[model samples]
Target: MESALSHRRFGSSDLMVSPLGLGTVKLGRDKGVKYPKDFTIPDDKAAADLIALARDLGINLIDTAPAYGRSEERLGKLLQGQRQDWVICSKVGEEFNNDSGDSHFDFSHRHTRQSIERSLDRLKTDYIDIVLIHSDGRDEHIIQHEGALEALQQCKQEGLIRAIGMSTKTVSGGLLAAELSDAVMVAYNPAHQEESPVLDYCARHGKAAILKKALGSGHLISEQDPAQAAMHFALSHPGVTSAIVGTINPEHLRENAEACQRALLQT
Candidate 1:
């Protein structure tokens, strides 16, 4: 667990997170859009052990969403009282509607409220450290659903969330959210650096820029040396406050932490 990796400030929020955060989307049973055959859902005990290993390695940020099947519930049951020193970030505006057999986004205020309550219940927490509006690059969906953003703002005012952010696929979507929200989480990496401008905008506005899909959804780590190079490339970006990499393996977690340290040393 001992390494040279250290913590950094998470944008304007008072919370400080490790450069490498845990992404729990894969922990969920339902893998939307992607082929189900590729999904690897970890057992509850294995997931808990992974979290404990990450904590021991000095990582404190855990990002999950209600749309991610049973991930929240599993995290709740595993890391409940054992993890008091962690920062948990979850997203609203999306849900796993079993009737549709797919996840759907509903930015309605009613859905937002329900999503937050459900996330709280599943996470077994009173307040979430960060709440993000998960948008999949749909302008019409976002413009038509102003109430969802307003609901997040209201939640921030009510102290249900420490900070509000937008998770989107496009730069424009992220930029729009950066202007309206407290932080922005977007897909960023060496191969696809289209979100650089959005990251700069977030940096200028004092909003956190969280990098998602940092390894291009496991493409970067398909090989050994490339994985380290990809991690270094993502963390080398000045605007990225942290990179959330999905993995339930403690060995991979340790390797990623070492990669971050290597990146720091190289810089």
Candidate 2:
């Protein structure tokens, strides 16, 4: 059967993405995460198998970041010869130091440009589908004072990125990002609804709202089929375009996709 989960336009951009995007943070990094438990990074063969499974389940959007240690590089190797089959979403402004297991932020113009170019090189792609500013809690200040967004806008103009936005950390930041960019990613789930105003604003303003931590970063899960309930709650919001669920488990990915499909149908 064809997928019940249909693709939606990402804001006003021409990129059509499935409602459930594959987040790849777990595919590369295992340290400095907020998950309920620890996990080993999947080997190349396992990662390739997981990617194939995601495609088979009708997921086209793959979310990654420089903060996701080795994610872009691994994807570059695994996604060889199949670049057209995925819409890659990457991030800048936050870099994960593998040796120290610490994260640092830089949203300056030079760092922003360097990050995009480095991502392009690591992904082995000429252009990325979407690029978001990885926030450091100072969402409002980052949007206003930093040059990352401006650099991303220039990248879009120059065709290095198809779309640019911020994975915002605040309601005000989300609203401002939506007004200035093609999309804004905010955290929204049953456990966290403080960002719903951002989604509502996106719904009314024709801006795309991409959700992160839709499962409460794996803390809100309880009982059987919690993914189904959590996904239903996230996707039921009218402003939501897609929710990025990071998992390296094949069974979990399939379950997440099915849950997303069921949620879309019910809504």
Q: Which candidate's TM-score is highest? A: 2
Candidate 1 off by > 4 Å: 33-39, 98-101, 139-145, 221-224
Which residue pairs collide in model 2, if any?
none
List, residue by residue over 1-267, the lDDT tens digit for candidate 2: 446457889988999998999999988888899898889999998999999988888899999999999999999999999999899999999999988899999999999999999999999999999999999989889989989999999999999999999999888988989999999999998888998999999999989889999988778857776789999999999999999999998988888999998898899
- Where does the lowest 10-residue lDDT sum fall in candidate 2? 1-10
Q: Give model 1's TM-score versus the native structure.
A: 0.92
| lDDT for predicted candidate 1 compared with the true structure | 0.81
- Per-candidate count of clashing residue pairs (backbone under 3 Å): 0, 0
